[model samples]
Target: MKRLVKGFAVSLLGLSMLVGCTTQAPGTGDKAAGDKKEQITVGLAISTQSNPFFVTLKEGAEKAAQENNIKLVTVDAQDDPAKQISGIEDLIQRQVDVILVNPTDSAAVVSAIKSANHANIPVITVDRSAEGGEVVSHVASDNVEGGRMAAKYLLEKIGKQGNIVELEGIPGSSAARERGKGFHEIIDKEKGVKVVAKQPADFDRAKGMSVMENILQGNKDIKAVFAHNDEMALGALKAIQAAGLKDVVVVGFDATDDAVAAVKEGRMSATVAQKPELIGKQAVELAKKVANGEKVEKNVPVELELIKK
Candidate 1:
């Protein structure tokens, strides 16, 4: 009977040791789970996803977020200022760590930027900028220089002595304003080049085609065309082709796939290339830095090049 009791005590001792080794103390497992790193969430507000350029930009942002283990929430404004404002407000309500915006209208976005400022959320502008808001950083190509490059190339191709139509982008957009400014600055200096017609197509292909058709009705002697974006440029090309026009030099900004193809086909004279993907990637990187209380430059300019075939 004594031997049996001793053996039973030894078995109980072995079982207790096994449990002590296999199981964690109460609350210890919960503490370990809580000690894991918290995820960072970023909110991206794009002007419109319909445009391929913004699509590429969005892809770049997504790639960066995935690589860095970040949680990204994206909303499309559909090129509506009000929609963009509401989108940002929604992101704010979600308590995102950072906010990135590609404003549809530079001036119209000021109110949204101010709202973000009030919420103490860092705002980073991508591709486009807000005219009157406190932005922590701006990531974009030098659009003015791009405009100048387009004008110079077109003038050279057209011999600097012909009537040209200017196809503008969306009104109140920084891209349109700056690009127009640069184009006119150079055209104004050349005595031989004349701007027969200038109109806004709202950075759309169909609108560009329609606007060009109207402009063609009054100005049949147009020798060249400069569009603020590839969409409008492609539209203008269609209009020119439909009109049975030939030898009209077309210059467009944004070296989109269609634009590059057009250039190779000799339909477009040239296009200014902006790295949309790089802009998106850099914006996310900057947002991450800003969210982590790191200092960064106020303005980061992406490089630009002129593509011609």
Candidate 2:
């Protein structure tokens, strides 16, 4: 009985040694941190899921995360810059390995990006850019080219000669800025095409409707409307119809599913198509590469298309 007790004690000691050699020390940012990692956490920040465009972008990101064996946490900023910054801060505290963000206010997100950098996590911007540094990469469509496409289509449709109004997107948004610049560069050069009214709609459908209604009250001679986004264009369409206006062409950006249907139904003249899904997918892939210490380009440009009936 004494010999058996001694043998059991010796075996127990040996087992303890083996377990200690295999187990990871309890701490943060350790090599074994990934060894026991059952799921990699990724953050997805978008403007709003209410918009069908962002819904598709969310789906693409979720699908990629699923395929790559990662857990995705998504937050909607509701087009509020403050909320966007808070959402990113929450994700960083969660210690997510990577973050994918579609900024509401590009400049506002800059500090959040720096915060993530302090945590040693990688941030990939999608659909929009942030002002300050610490961004690993950015993936988005060429908004300027999209705007140019819209202007080109409108010029062809109206023989490059018409009075038009522009319904701008939310101010301080990179998409709105670039798209507006592109459209102005084209329309400004054309002697016959005149943009008589340009107003900021905050990229809301209702605001777009109200702005269009007000513009119509003063400028009944407007022949065309260019909206920074499809949602605003849809709103403008309602206003134009209510005014009993006809033969007024309306063009929009971001060819969402609803926008495509609108085009087929003759509700909208045309839309500049952007691949939100591709943007989402590319953002995930870039995050993975950055986490793996791989280098990626600062800008990954997605193609744009002009959709017309």
Candidate 3:
């Protein structure tokens, strides 16, 4: 009887030890620190997702956010400055760890950026930049360089001596300003090449078609067209085709899928490819670094590629 009692006691002791080994006290294991990883929330305010480029940009940001275990709250400004301002304010109210903005208008977004600054939230601008207010970082392709490449390509196709139309993007946006500057820099140096018509399409396809139609009515001698983005380029192509005009070279920026397909079909002469996805992903990474109190560069530029047939 004494031996059996001792054996039972030993078995109980062994079971208790096994249970203790399997079940550790909360916050006392190798995974305690990992399990307690800080939950980060990021806010993204985009100018508009109506554009395929911005849509792709949002996808990239979401992918990075998922990979890093972050919660992303996104708002669309619908290309309205006031709406963009309101969106930023909403983000600030949410107490997000970081804010990422794709400004509708560089100059107009200053107040919104300042609002974020006042709230002590770090701001990272993607694609378009703000004209005022403090931004921790900016992620985008070199618009000036992309524009220069487009101009050079168009000039080469047209023999550097032809009437070309310039289709501008939204006014006051850094992309439109910088791209125009770079394009004019090259076109100005060539004496034979003249920009016969320049107009703003607001980066809208229908607007681009209408603008091109109006320009074509007055300038039938146009040999090529340079649009700020592929949406406009495709619209211009439609107008050109409707007019039964052939051999007119059309170059564009932001080589979206449709634009690339057009290039493959020989509908467009060429396009400057900007990786919207990469830009968004980098912006999110930068925002994460900022949230973690890590230093980041002022500007992160993704490379641009020329896509042609």
Candidate 4:
């Protein structure tokens, strides 16, 4: 009985050693603090999910995170700059490896980006850019070029010599600013083309309809309408139809699903098509690179196309 007891104790000690060794092996649970991270955490601060365009962007990001075995924390700003700031603050508190921000307002989001900078966290802008920040990368479509496409198509439709109304996006947004700049660069050169009115609808479909209604009420001679986004374009379309206006060319940007459907059904004349999903995917891909201390470009522009009926 004494010999058996001693042997059992020796076997127990050997089994413990084997278990300890297994745990200490490289790539096992007992990795040291400095080992390369097995999984990365990414925080996505989206502007608003209410817009279908943004929803698609979020889905793309989520998909990429899954494929890469990354953990993603998402917060929706609901189009409020203040909310975006708070959400980013939360992300910082969570100690996420990287942040992907879609600013509600270019200038208003500067402070949020600055906070991330102070936290030593890399920030990558998606879709819209911040006016001031230490962003490692910016992924988006060239809004200026997209605007040029929309303007050229609308002008051709209206014969390049007509009074047109411009439905601008939320004031101070980078998309709104750049798109407007590209549009004016072309429309300003044409003496025959005149902008009868330009109004900001805050990128809201309901507001777009109301603003268009007001403009339509005031200007019967307006020959065409150009909205900065598909939502606004659809709103303007409803107003135009309600007012029984015809022969007025309508063009919009951001070829969202509904907008594409409208174009196919001939409700909209044309739209500048942007791949929101591709933009989101590219942003995440860059985010992973940035988190891993990889070098990337400052500005990554996704391709844009024009969709017509």
Candidate 5:
């Protein structure tokens, strides 16, 4: 009986040791589970929060991050390239797993990208892509096609023959350049349709108003106006209303909610709706995939729709 009891005690001791090695402590197990959950930090570098398009994009990104269990940090450049570089540097310092950049200047952000690359963080370009780099991916609407769509609508509305003015966006942006190129490519071919005045508004509502006011001084026969973005288009609409111009068709880009309202009200002719939310969602999805060593395409194209009411 004594031997049996001793043997039983030894067996119990061995069993306790095995349990200690195999079982995790309560809090420790919870912590291990939490640690196993995927956690990533994403940096969003955007041009301006002033634009409703960017606002929607930000919202979409935040929602996507939350759904995927990621931490998102957003910084706005406020339309300044230098400020954008500074913002990117700050994001790098934070040691984010990936960066999503909507560059203020395509060329200016190249060095910033190189800096991020040195830190071994993947950079994904959104909206307006950075000029030079092996970025993980770039997601944006087809600006050239949007421009063509707008021009085609305007041409049809004006009976393909009239004087039109163009309020362009920022000088160095790919959005501005492509839109302008596409606009002129179509209108330039129309014999009676003349682009009487063209000026840069820097994609600012107030600046667009000022530029349009100046153009109005010289060109009173303007049959239509095409502003690069909706904000600029809205500004020009204000100017046209103030100038008392009748039947002067106005077209714009980046169909924000306000722009859609404007179209519905018949104050604006049409807008190229570049769905920013979709772009934002795609951008975050691609960033996560790339970070996880999954394959993603270099270029993802977002659709542009011309909304006319």
Candidate 6:
């Protein structure tokens, strides 16, 4: 009977040892189910998923976040400033460790950015920047430079002298403002190039098409076109085609897959390429640095290039 009792105690001891080994404490760097305890949570508020650029940007951020073991929470603003503000407020309510925002409207986003500031949350702007509030870092390409590049390439294709139509992006966004600034900086200096039409398409494809259709009705002598983004460029292309107008040099920014394919097919003259994936990955890395109280550059720029056939 003593031997039987002793065997039972031995079995109990073995069972206890197994439990101790398997059910270790939550955060000892164990590859356990609750390993997220060691992760820093990051909140990503994107402008819109309707645009492919933001979609690719989100994928890059997610990839980097996963590689770094960061817990990421994403909210889409659907290109509405009010929705963006409310979404950011939700992120703040969640008390995320850091915030990466791709603002819909630079001016309108200031209120939401200020809210994040009030909550003591560090914010890092991705792609588009806010006009007001404090931001720890901003990650993007040199949009002004890209604008100049696109303009220069378009001028080269059109022989540097023509009546051109400019398709603008969202009015209040920094990208639209900066790219326009850069484009006019060069085009304004050239006396031979006349701007026949200038209008905003809100950086949307369908809007681009409709706006171009309207512009084409009045100004059919357009020699070249520069769109702030590829979506608009593609839309404008559709309008130009539907109107049976051929040989208009259509240049776009953001070398999205569709834009690149268009360029290859000789439909689009060229496009300025910005590495959105790199921007996203870098933004997450910078956010991690900010969370750990590590120093980082205030403005981080990704490279931009011109893509043509």
For every candidate, C-alpha RMSD to the true structure in Å: 7.8, 5.0, 8.9, 5.5, 7.4, 7.1
TM-score-best of 1 and 4: 4
TM-score of each: 0.88, 0.89, 0.89, 0.90, 0.88, 0.88
lDDT of 6 by residue, 1-309 (tens): 999999999999999999988786665535655333468999999999999999999999999999999989999999999999999999999999899999999999999999999999999999998898999999999999998898888878888888999999999999999999889988888888999999999999999999999999988988999999999999999999999998999999989999999999999999999988899999999999898888999999999999999
- Candidate 2 lDDT over 1-309, as tens digits, reads 999999999999999999987776566436554454556788998988877788888898888888888788998999999999899999998999889989898888888889989999888889977778588788999898888888988988899888999999888888899999999888899999899999999777899999999999998887899999998999999999999999889999888888899899998999998988878887887777776668899899998988889
Candidate 2 stretches greater than 4 Å from native: 1-38
Candidate 6 lDDT trough over 10 residues, lowest sum? 28-37
TM-score, model 5 to reference? 0.88
- For the record, the alpha-carbon RMSD of candidate 5 to the native fold, in angstroms, is 7.4
Tens digits of per-residue lDDT, candidate 5, 54-100, equal: 99998989989989988999999999999999999999999998999
Instruction: Choose 4 or 6, whichever is better by TM-score.
Output: 4
Q: Candidate 3 lDDT, tens digit per residue, 1-309? A: 999999999999999999988888776655643343377899999999999999999999999999998899999999999999999999999999899999999999999999999999999999998999999999999999999999999999999898999999999999999999999989999999899999999999999999999999987898999999999999999999998899999999999999999999999999999999999899888888888888999999999999999
Native-vs-model 2 lDDT?
Answer: 0.88
RMSD of 2: 5.0
Cα lDDT tens digits for candidate 1, 51-159: 8889999999999998888899999999999999999999989989899999999998899889889999999999998998789999999999999999889888988
Q: Which residue ranges in model 4 land beyond 4 Å of their true spot?
A: 1-34
lDDT of 5: 0.91
Indicate which candidate wins on TM-score.
4
Candidate 6 TM-score over all chains jointly: 0.88
- Scored by Cα lDDT, where does model 1 land? 0.91
Angstrom error of the Cα, residue 100, model 2: value is 1.1
Which 10-residue window of candidate 1 scores lowest in summed lDDT? 28-37
Off by over 4 Å in 6: 1-37
